[model samples]
Target: MNIHIIWDEANLPIIKSNLSNVIDVIDDTIAVSFDTWLFSSNGEFVIEFYHDGQTIIGLK
Candidate 1:
């Protein structure tokens, strides 16, 4: 299982310490939007955070 995390640079330490299953950690510097519907029916585990807004997605 590979986990893709979209987050800010400031949270790097937190991500490194807490998440051991993360495969890719993408900084949110790029101008992109993630539509919930796009991942809603994928049957994968998706976590959306409001504060700091870190998106964690699991892909097979």
Candidate 2:
């Protein structure tokens, strides 16, 4: 499946400069919730969705 990433203008530049070639740019709603599962080297935690340029450093 193709993952669509919605980002704000401020973060767009950086994302574009960096991850644009990797991920697809999405302009629609980014859905997340307390039920959302996130895992990293640090640990696991619940997460929510935001569109203002947050760095995603873990599980896709």
Candidate 3:
């Protein structure tokens, strides 16, 4: 099974720091990240169902 994630705005500094490391490596003008602040849902917690259902927000 798979689940989607949302990045909590509360964690952006950590995200920027991590991205900066990647930018230093790739040496580019624009910075981007393909990282996630894990869900702790790795077969450990039961996922909830919402009335709207099934959106793939892809921090995959």
> Which numbered prediction scores highest in TM-score against the true structure?
1
Model 1 score (lDDT)? 0.36
lDDT of 2 by residue, 28-53 (tens): 32332212222232334223344454
Better of 1 and 3 by TM-score: 1
Best by lDDT: 1
- Checking candidate 1 for backbone clashes, the offending pairs are none
Error of 3 at 22 (Å): 18
lDDT string, candidate 3, 1-60, tens digits: 332332434554432233335335532311222333323234343222222433222242
Estimated TM-score for each candidate:
0.26, 0.19, 0.18
lDDT of 1 by residue, 13-60 (tens): 222222332323333322233322112233365555434455444553
Residue pairs clashing in model 3 are none
What's the C-alpha lDDT at position 52 in model 2? 51
Q: Any idea what lDDT model 2 has?
A: 0.31
State the lDDT at 30 in candidate 3. 19
Worst 10 residues of 2 by lDDT: 32-41
> Which stretch of 10 consecutive residues in model 1 shows the poorest summed lDDT?
29-38
* Candidate 1 vs. true structure, TM-score: 0.26
Candidate 3 wrong stretches, greater than 4 Å: 10-35, 40-60
